[model samples]
Target: MAPEVRTNVNLKPYRQALALPGLRPLLLVSVLARIPFTATSLALTFYVLLELERGYGAAGLVGAAMTVGAALGAPLLGRLVDRYGLRPVLALTTVAEAVFWSTAAVLPYPVLVGAAFLGGLLNLPLFSVIRQSIAAMAPPDQRRPAYALDSMSVELSFMIGPALAVALATSFSPHLTLYAVGAGIVGSGITLFLLNPPTRGSDEPTGPVGPPSRRAWLTPRLFGVLAVSTACTLVLGGTDVSVVAALRDGGEVRWTGLVLTVWAVASLVGGFAYGALTRPVPPWVLLAGLSLTTIPIGLGGGTWWLLCLALVPAGLLCAPTIAATADTVSRLAPVGARGEAMGLHGSAITVGVALGAPLAGAVIDHTVAGWGFAVTGLIGLLVALAVLPTELRRRRIAADHAAAERAAPEQTAGDDRKQSPTVGGPNGELVGTEH
Candidate 1:
């Protein structure tokens, strides 16, 4: 007899998801590919500062150029992927990125700045591809876990990537680190391309037919998901700034790194636990939890150890919120447009961090450091609460429209009966319809 497939509501989802054909390799390649992404900015900063002997302002400008490039590149590259398929896009980007970095190390400061911008613009949309693939391949029930796994991989990359860059740059030369980064990108990109993971099914479009509809895949629900993701990350950025400032104030600057690591670990653990469950928490609930938990963190500014404990609740919500947003995007985004959707999702995150840190820093400079955490938490909570009413109204309208559609056939049938001509006698029994 054939063996029966194992099943459990709690544990089976993740197991089954991993068991899906071609998923594991894709996941592995995705993680490896993204390591360079996390490493690049830090490495670039060090490179410009140390090797080129540029000032912080120049380094900052170069970094900003990269960020701008990434923001612009994502949607454009994603659209290309949707139109032309993954392999060609990945192939072109891989070649371009490899060449860009290889040449960047030898270029002058003026040229390096422009090169950085181009590199960012042409950076392979690895994260977008992976998320889109997971959304496409995983069963609907298994997606939460799949996305959660993806989020955890991202967390791990963040944990390792920057540190690795710093270690390599500090120990060896920054030029060597740049070369290593370029090599990593090329190697990972080639592996993923050759593996040829199933990004979309046969039904999905491989190329564009004509101009897209005016009301395209970016629906209101998807917009809401992106907005919530941005808000959550913004809060995270603010929290980071506050924690560092508070630690500095308490003369526990040395403990700041440890505290942040612990905070990230909490988020990683939360992602694992959230993914294991059969049911996942809603994005709004996670957002609320994140905001609520952060409020108490500001209260611990006097004691660094106390602040570490306060960070736990907010940190726990981090990965889950990210995972939940990914899941939401999967559900809300239309089939052919998922690549662009995922691209937009990543952009939202970058934008959030870009906005949050500076705004929070400004707040800290203007007021006390502790107020940064408080204001960040409050902003997140308020945003979530404010969006709730609009979301509710949209959902209600959708439900009414759906109900009307369901009732439409019956209403049409009834009207037809009322308008039908009667061939029978005075009893008013309708026997025939009008010719």
Candidate 2:
């Protein structure tokens, strides 16, 4: 006799999600990858300062290189994922990252920047792949928690990575810190490659391959979500530049790092503590509120205390909005298209940062630091208003579905008697739909 598959409909909700086999591996890989990704941000600046006698500008350039590469490369890598499976592609990317990150450890500033750019190119699709995997492997009700967990992991990396980099740079040298980061990324990548996350073993079946290409990305739903995400990120991206410039102006430039560090730490706290209670906030409204709240960033609270106070609310928006976007994407995307959906979402983030930085930097460099915040706030307002109608429509659809589900009968003796012959469930109940 064949072994009967286990079943447990009564499983505790939280426990049920935790039972998902692929979830932990996905989280592990995410945390590991982000270690180097975030730490490098801190280390690169020190590398420029120590070896090349370059200023913050070089560090800024390194940040731009990483963002630009990730933006350009995600879509292509995503397309490849649709054709090939994740394992080989992941292994190849990881190997390239390993090679480049190690080499970058000892290279001169120019060489290191070039290597960093290359590393960014090779690092494409990892985050999107993991997100797509989580969507495929987790149960429907469990998806929100999965995304929450993933967002939290990102926040964790942001919190710990720079701080760790600071400690290492203070104790050892920037080169040594870079070497350590390289080793960590390589080791983590190898682990992910070896364990191969469940997505490696088999392909998730996507019913009826969607459109011919990613042409559907321009569709209203995705485009709308992308717009909101980008707007939200612009607030974040622009705020970083504005704050840095303002600090520079106030002769508190050193505090720029500290303020950013504080912001990241607050974000970390918010992510871990975001429980199931926040589900009451509809995704669309949540996104708009998050974006709209960012308008305060432009407020010239010149004192450090006021600036710090302003950041907590601004920082709070970061993970929650991202989690909302992830939730929306998971529901809307077809199975195989998750990677592309996530890639596009990631691209929006990169584009926001890229656009926001230079635009704000120009204002600061030319006019004044404060205008940087105002310009980005306007962008945020535009994106939020543009996407509002769609968010409302989605909410209505969800409400109607919930109402339908509520009215459905759970069981009926008459219905049971009318069950058509064919398949039988494990409990010997008629499983086929009644004609």
Candidate 3:
């Protein structure tokens, strides 16, 4: 069936994107896969504190170890996907993750930390794979809407996954919840393996084998896209730290969760609105919007309500920034290297968070809570500016290269005709131009 085409982004296109063949299953499994990504940390924290009778300090360390493992693993797994195929890599990781989680449930505290790290390191790169699949499966024009929907789904997952994990852990047994989460991960992994979406080399190549080209996948344009994405996440991470600080300062630490929820809801709305626009906004513009909106959030120091209000404008830009960056990464990455590029994009996000949290906490410790927001926002703007020239130059070069390639075939055909003489008479006389 011919996929529906749209002149503008709207509700209809979003529906159409979902209805596309092969995409629905992918999206469904992707959401399932993401549950563990969002839920496991919360579940682990609870498991350590409640079941093992450990301190929050121990739980935090374990969680940090898991995150570090995932961060380190994402790019390597993506590179493997690019070099080999998706199914084998996913299958291996699926088995590893299931085994790790199962073992983790029974291990001692010290051993459990290491197991969690290994599990996270080998965690199925389902989210990265899904994002790459969307780029591969969706038509060019539909990608904007596709990415928007993708971003929205992630937000929904964040809202549901962590809360569900905590509730189940608190109401039931933490160990049981961890087992359940592991089972869900296994199911998601199996589903993805069965689906076996295509990567660059899924089919046999037509050309003869030779030395690989020295060209790299991390082109400057893609680097810019990744940078913008990292900056956006950095802002969010900093906001998280600053929000906690602000709430604690005001003695309303309990309201921190509520305030963040409000911020998240605003971002969800922004994703919908951004998706519906006829033209997607540029990455720089979205980043600028975020920085400008975020800068004032620090001024809302007195109460949680004021902080919530200040966050609304910045929150509105969050999903848009993410969606735009995803779309840009899809566009910038070559077909052969899409998996690795997307993996790097995912890595950029994790790195941003890893750095932003510590940076913001340091700032807050040295100065006041509000400066965390101010400092992060200013840094984001500076990063946007720093990459502007390089991004512009890369864009121009890419456009020129594309233009040359487009004209090459015509030029080659003309030269071939010029070299071969055409017969002008019945005697097969060669006709040559005198001019």
Candidate 4:
């Protein structure tokens, strides 16, 4: 009597992801986390400009305050996750966020900055925990797709949050909008607390991750990844500066917000599209492609026409590059230390962001106007080329290892049959063992 039996093959994947008891909860929790975190990029600049009587120059301070807190938080949180399970620590974070945001909402200017800094301290760890949760719960093949979908979700959130925040803060009170953002953050932190994600860390772990995590920044591969990711950030940062300056030079400074929003929106679409690829490309290929595409971003001068299209490629590049990085981190993580790994990965990103704007600004100050874009694009291209051979080797190694694992069981069974005691003459051991 259930409405005409429908054999629906399309529901297979949805069914599977849904079948994961915790996925929906995690997704819901993630939505809550994203709204406020992204709102910072969207609203704070306006808050400073409009309410605090600060000019555009204050934007840098706001960004720096948040990021420096986050940079310091990353390692601390990663260490926490390594010591305690993700649940307890994440719960504490949510409570901290609730307190910080609520107090910041009513605080004075100096107090507000302090709150923002503390919020940053509490913020960056959320995403890393979420990443670790996905790795813990998802099967091998689904892990990449899950990460892809998460990236897409964040992209979509960014596209929406910034544009909407700018509009709402302008139309209404900036304080009102920021308060709303604070509420959104608290809600997400609570959600994460409730949905205790699957744990990869064991009670009796194999590695040395229990009490105090070792000073692992000395590891070579970790350093290498940071270098690569940091380079990518510099390219993006430079591109941001170049476009902003070019727009000002062309007397289209007002369009800066609009152009950036458009770029974020395009990236939202591209990330979703990238996630949908049937046979997902390896991270290296996507990385190289993403790096090369920076050419358009750097080259698109303030010609009104190029503004619309130049950033599309850059936006499009965002999700794929991140998705690839997520994959690489997953593969690189130790069995029980994914949370720490993700946090470290996040810190690298923060380092990149912190380094990027200044690097671009310096290049622009001393050089030709157009050199900003050209230099950034060239740097990206060179990085792509320099890393290609290493990436190729890594991929080859991964493939070979995968092949060996797939063949191991069959090979083991065959060997067992040959060496196992046989019943050739009713004395099972004599024929094969000769004992």
Candidate 2 lDDT over 1-435, as tens digits, reads 999998644324445556788777678778877877678777877877876678888888886787777787776676566557667778878788778767776677777677777777777366677777777777557776677678878877777787888899889998888788877777766776776654322455633344355565446888887777677677777888888887777777767767887677766555544434435344455556655655665565445556677778767767767776776776776655666677788788778767887887887777777788777777777777777788678779999999877666544555767877778789988667777
lDDT of each: 0.83, 0.71, 0.82, 0.68
Per-residue accuracy of model 4 over 219-240 as CA lDDT, tens digit each: 4455456556656666666777
- State which candidate has the highest lDDT: 1
List candidate 4 segments past 4 Å from native. Answer: 1-19, 55-59, 105-115, 201-219, 253-258, 278-284, 365-370, 385-435
| lDDT for model 3 | 0.82
Clashing residue pairs for model 2: none
Q: What C-alpha lDDT, on a 0 to 100 scale, does residue 351 get in candidate 3?
A: 74
Question: TM-score for model 3?
Answer: 0.83
lDDT of 1 by residue, 1-435 (tens): 999997644667778889977788877877777888789888888999999998878988898887788878887887777777889989989998888889989998888888888988988888888888898788778898888888888888888888899999999989999999889988888988898776675556555534255277666667777888888888998988899899888889989878888898899988888998876677877888898898778888747779879898888889999999989887777766777788888888777776677778989999878888888888888878866876788879999999999899999998887775668757967576655
Best-fitting candidate, scored by TM-score: 1
**RMSD list, candidates in order:** 5.4, 9.8, 5.8, 6.2
User: Over 4 Å off in model 3, which ranges?
Assistant: 1-9, 200-214, 395-435
Give each model a TM-score: 0.87, 0.77, 0.83, 0.77
